[model samples]
Target: MIPKYRKQFNKEFSDEKYSQLKGILAKKGGIEPTFRISESPIFLTKEFESKLIDASESIISQIKTLPAEILQKAIPDNCRVPNDTDKPHFFTIDFGICRSENGAIEPQLIELQAFPSLYAFQKVYEETYCEVYPFLSEIRNPMSHETFKNHLKELIVGDENPENVILLEIFPEKQKTAIDFSLTEKLLGIKTVCLTKVKKEGLKLYYENDEKHTEIKRIYNRVIFDELDNIPDLKTEFDFREEVDVKWITHPNWFFKISKFLLPLLKHQFVPKSYFLHEFPEHESLENFVLKPLFSFAGSGVNLNPTIEITSAIKDKENYILQRKVNYEPLFEDINREFSKAEIRLLYIWRENDEYPILLENLGRMTKAAMVNVDFNKKDAIWIGSSNAFFG
Candidate 1:
C-alpha cells in the first residue's frame, strides 16, 4: 500500500462523501448491492502488482502441464457436463498480501476459479471511485475501462447477437449478486434469465422475451453446480448435463477441474501447502491447517482450526482438503488506529487463440475478521468490505 495516497484519501474521507458514493452506485448499477462496499480503495506499488502477476502465471503454467487423466479425475461423476471447452475463457485467482519468513511482504495464493466474476460491475465500481475522489483518476488502474469492456464483450457476446446471449443463473433476482446482473444487462445489452425460465424444445433451448420465444445461442453461466445438485425439488426445462444447442462461455466442467480440487497439485512459492484429507501424510500437525470442502463456494463449510478427531469423523475423506493457513498482514490503518487485512483477486481472460490467460483487472476485499467473507465481518466495522485496487 502507498502511504501518501492512503493518508491523503483518509484525510479527505467523510461520512457524507461515503453516502454520496452509495447513492451514485445505486443510480449507476440500477440497484443497491446486498453486500458491504468498503470506504476506501487500496493503492498498490508497481512492484507488488508485478509479484501478483508472476505468482498467477506460475500456477497457470503448472495447470497447463497437468495430464488429462488427472483433470478428468478432478470432476465428480455426477457433476460432469457434456461438450466442455478445452480451455477456460475466464480465471479469477485470490492472493492474500502477507509477510514472508524473511519479513519481506509478499502475496500468498488463497484460491483460484475458472469462472467469470464481476467483470461488468467492477469496472463501473472503479470508475465511480474516480468520479468521487478526483485525485484517484491520476493513478492508473490495472486495466483501462475501455479495454476491459471490450474484452468482456468479446468473451460474453462473441460474434453472436446480444439478444441471443443470456446471463444464466438460478433465481438471479433473489441472489446477493443481483446488482451485477442488472449492470451487465445495462452495459452489454444482454438479458439475465433464471434457470427455470429456459424452455427446451428437442435439442435447442429458448427463453421468452416480450411474449415471444427467443432462441438461445450462448450462455454466460453463473450457476453453481453444487447448489443446483442440492436442490432436490427444483425443476428445469433444460439440464446443464444434457447436450444443448447453446455454446457455454467458460464451460461448467472447468469449475471443478480448476478449483480447490487442483490446489494440492500446484507447486509454487506463492501457493500454500495443500493436501487432500485422504492423502495427508502422517505426523503433520493439524493445528496450523484449515479444512475446506473441495467444491464449496464463497468460503462456505470452512473450518479455520481442525483437529485430528474432526478430520477422522468425516465419511467422505476425498471431498475435503487440508490447507495451510495463511497469515494475513493487517495492512490498512484506519483513523481509529484499527487495522484490517486485505486480499486481492486477479481477474484474467483467455481468448480463443491466446497462449494462456492474461491478467486484466483486480478485485480487493478488506476485513478485520478471520476470513474475508461477509459472514465473518463485524457489522460496525469501518474501511472494511468489498473494494477495488488502484495500481501506480
Candidate 2:
C-alpha cells in the first residue's frame, strides 16, 4: 500500500464526500449496495503488485499440475454437476497482505474460487471512487473498464443473444450482492433468473422472458452447492446434476474442484500450511490453526481459535480443513491513524483455450474484525468494508 496516497485521501476525506460517493453509486446501479463500500481504495506500488502476481501465478501453476483423480475427488458424489467444462472460466484468488516471520511485508493466500465474483460492479465502483477523488485517477486497475467489459461480454454472452444467456442464481433479487446481478444485466443485456424458475422441457431448459418462455442457451451460475443443499425442501424443475442443453459459463463443478477443497494440495510461499482434518498431525497445536468447512462461503463456519475438543467432536472430518493461521498486518491507516486488516482478491478470467487465467482487477476488503465478512466487523465501522486496489 502507498502511504502518500493513503495520507492524502484521509486528509481530504469528509462525511459529505463519502455520502456523495454512495449516492452516485446507488443512482447508477438503481440500488444502494447491501455491503458497505470502504471510504478509500488502497494504492498498491509496482513492487507489491509484482509480488501478488508472482504468488498467484505460482499457485495456479501447481493447481494445473494436480492429477485428474485428485481434482475429481474434490467434488462430492451428490454435488457432481453434469457436463462440466474442461477448465474454469472465472477464477478468483484471495490474499492477505501481511508481515512474514522475518518482519517483511508479504501476500499470504487466504482462499481461491473458480466461481464468478462481482465482475461488472467492480469496474463501476472503482471508476466512481476516482470520480469523487479527482487526484487519485492516475492509480487505476491494471485493465481498463472498457477492456474488462468487452472481455466479460465475450465470455458470458458470447456469440449467442444476451437474452438467451441468463445469470442464474437462487432468488437473486433478495441476495445482498444483487447490485452486481443488476449491473450484469444492464451491461450485458442478460436477465437474472431464479434457479427454481427454470423450466425443464425434455433435455432443454427455459425461463420466462417478458411473460413468454425463452430457451436458455447459457447459464452464468451463481448458486452455491452448500446453500442449495441446505434448502432441501425447495423444489426446482431443473437439476444441476441432470444433462441439460444449456452450456455453463464456468460450469458448476468448478465451484467444488477449485475451492478450499484444493487448498491443502497447493504449495506456495504465500500459502499457509494446510491439512485435511482426517490427515491432520496429532502433534500439531490446534491453537495455531483455524478450522474451516470446505464448502461454506463467506467465512460461514470458520473457527479462529480451535481447541482439541472441537476438532475431535466434528464427525465429518473429510468435510473440514485445519489451516495454519497467518497474522494479518493492519496495513490501511484511517483518519485517526488506526489501521485495518485487509485482504486483496485478484480476479481472473480464463478463456476457452487459454493456458492460464488472466489477472484482470482486484477486490479488496478492509476489516477491523477477526474475519473480512461484514458480520464480523463492528456495526459503526467506516474505514473497513468492501474496497478495490489501485495499482500505479
Candidate 3:
C-alpha cells in the first residue's frame, strides 16, 4: 500500500464519487459479490508485483515434482482412477503472501480447492471498476477483464459446444459461492446444474431441462468430493473417477498436487517452512508458526500466533500443518484508519492451446484485524476482501 496514492485519492474523494461507484456496480449486477467486496480497490507498487509473480512460480515448480501417489491418496474413491489414466482433477491453488521475519516477502500457502474459483465475477468486477472510475488516470488495470473472460471461455469450452459443457456443482444454490456459478452461467453460456439433477444413462451423463435431456460432454467441476461425501441422501448414478463421457476442467489429482502439504517441499526465499503436525521436528520454540488444516476453506481452521497447548490439542495431527507466520506489511496507506494487512490473489487461467498459465485478473483482501481471513476482519474495516486496482 502506497501512502502517496492514498492521500491523493482520499483528498479528492467525494460522496458523489462513492454514489457513482455504488450505482455502476448495482447496474452491472455486482452489488453482491459471492465473497466480500471492499469499499475501495488497492493500488500496488511494481516492485511488490514482481515479487508476487516470482513467489508463485517457485511454488508451481514444487507442485510439478510431487509424487503421483501423494495426490492419489487425497482423491475420493469415486474420483480415484482405477488402474490407468490417473490424471488429477482440475483446480487452482491460492496463496496469501506477506513479508516474513527476514525482510523478504514470501507466500503463505492458503486453501487449495478442488472446485472452480470466482473466475467469472473477477472479470466482471475489473471491468466495472475501470468503467465506473475512469477518472483515476494514474491507476491502470494490469489485465483486461474481457481478456480474462475470453480466456476462461476458451479453457472451459474449447472446440466443444458450450451446451455440452456444464459447470458442475452440488446444490449450487445452497453453496456459499453460488454467485460465482451464476456469473459463470451468464458469461460462458453454460448451465450451472446440481449433481443430483444429472441423469446417467449408459456411459453418458445428461441433464433434463424443460422436458428435454441434453447430453453432457464436459464438466467444469466445482464439487468438492470431500464435502459431497458428507451428504448421504444426495444420489448420482455415475462416479467422477470412473470412465465417463465428459472431460474435467481440472482433473481431481491436481488438487492434491498443489496443496499446503507441498509447501515444505518447495525451495524459495518467499515461502515459509511448513510440515505436517505429526511430523514436526523437536524445536526450542513453537511460537514462530501457525497451525492450519490440510483441507479447509476461507481460513476455517488456521491458528495464528499458535501456542504449545494449541498444537497439543490437535487430535488429527495428520490433517494439521504448522507453518511459519509471515508478517503482513500493510501496503495501502491512504485510508485514515488503523493499519490493515492484505493478500493479493493473482487469478490465472490455462486455456486449451496455452502452454503456460495466463495471469488473467486479481482480487485483493485487506484486514484491519490481526489476520486476513474473515474471522479477523472488523465490521467497518476499510478495503478488506475486495477487488484491487493493480497499477501497471
Candidate 4:
C-alpha cells in the first residue's frame, strides 16, 4: 500500500462523496462498502504491476505440475464423491499477499472456492470507483470492467445463444451471496436457477420460466458439494457429474486443479515453505507454520498459531497443509482513524479464444482486525468484504 496516496485521500475525504458511492452501490444492489475510496486512484508503477504479474505466472506454472491424483486425494471426506465425475466444474483462485519478513513481497494462498465469486458486481464496482473519484487520472486499475463482461460471455456462451446457458447454483435465492448471482443474470442475460429447479429431459437440463421450459446447454456452476450435505431433504433428479449434459465454465476438475494443495508445489520466494501435514517431518518445534484444512472455504479451521497437541489431533494429516504465516502490514492510512488492513485479490478470466488468461478484475478486502476474515475483523469496521476503489 502507498502511504502518500493514503494520506492525501484521508485529507480530502468527504462524507458526501461516500454517500454518493453508497447510492451507486444501492442501485446495483451492493451492500454499502466500508473502506475509504481514495480521492485519487493509487498508482501502481510498472515495476509493482510487473511484480504482481510475475507472482501470478509463478503460481500458474506451479499449478500446471500438480498431479490430478493428489487433488482427488485431498477432497474433504465429507464432500468426497466416488470419482471425479461428481465434482463441480471449474475454479477461480484468490491470492493474498504482503511484504514478507525478508522484505521481498510474496503471496499466501488464502481462500479457494468451488462456487462462483462476485464477478459481475466487481465490474460495476470498478465503474463506480472511476465515477465517484475523479482524481485517479495517473494510475490504471489493470482490470477493465467491460473486458470482464465480454470475457465471461466468451467463456460461458462461446458461439451458442446466451439463453441456452444457465448460471447454476443451489437454492440460489437463499444463498448469502445471491446479489452477485443476480448481477450475473443482469449482465449476461442468463437465468440463475437452483439445482432442484433444473429438470432432466433425456440428456439436456432445463428450467421453467413463466410456465414454459427452456433447455440448458451450458452451466456456469456455483454449487459447492460441501454445502449440499447441510440440507439433505432438497432432492434433485440428476447428479452433477453423472447425468448433466451441459458444458461447464470451469470444468469441475480445475477446482482441485488450482487449490491450496498446489501451494507447496509452487516454487517462488513469495510462497511460504509448505508441506502436507502427514508427510511433514516430525518436529517438536512446530510453531513456525500454520495448519489449514485443504478444502475449507474462507479461513475456517485454520490454526494460525498451532500447538503440538492440536497438530497431533489431525486425523488425516494429508488432508491438511502447513504454511508459513505472512504478517500483513497494516499500510492504509485513515488520519489517526483505525487502519483497515487489506489484501488484493487479482482476478483472471480464461477464455477459449485467448491463448492465456486475461487479468479482468482486482478485488480488495479490508478489515480492522489482525487478519482479513470475519472472525478476526473488528466490530463496526467500516470497510470489509468485497470492495473496489479508484486507482488512476
RMSD of each: 1.1, 1.1, 3.0, 3.5
Report the C-alpha lDDT of model 1 over 174-235, residue by residue, as the tens digit. Answer: 98888889998988899999999999999999999878799999999999976897877999
The C-alpha TM-scores of every prediction are 0.98, 0.98, 0.87, 0.86
Candidate 1 global CA lDDT score:
0.88
Instruction: Kindly list the per-residue Cα lDDT of model 3 for residues 245-305, writing each as its tens digit.
Output: 6777866555544566666566677667888888889973578788888776567778887
Report residue 253 deviation for candidate 4 (angstroms).
Answer: 2.7
Winner on TM-score between 2 and 3 is: 2
Q: For model 2, give the 10-residue run with minimal summed lDDT.
A: 137-146
- The residue ranges of model 3 lying beyond 4 angstroms of the native Cα positions read 14-23, 73-97, 100-115, 136-139, 313-315, 352-355
Number of clashes in model 2? 0
Worst 10-residue stretch by lDDT in candidate 3? 82-91
Measured with C-alpha atoms, the lDDT of residue 120 in candidate 2 is 82
Instruction: Summarize candidate 4's per-residue lDDT along 75-122 as a digit string, tens digits.
Output: 554444333433333335555546676786445555544345667777
TM-score computed on alpha carbons, candidate 1: 0.98
Q: List the residue pairs that clash in candidate 2.
A: none
Better of 1 and 3 by TM-score: 1
Which 10 residues in a row give candidate 1 its minimum summed lDDT?
Answer: 140-149
Q: Give lDDT: candidate 3, residue 353.
A: 51
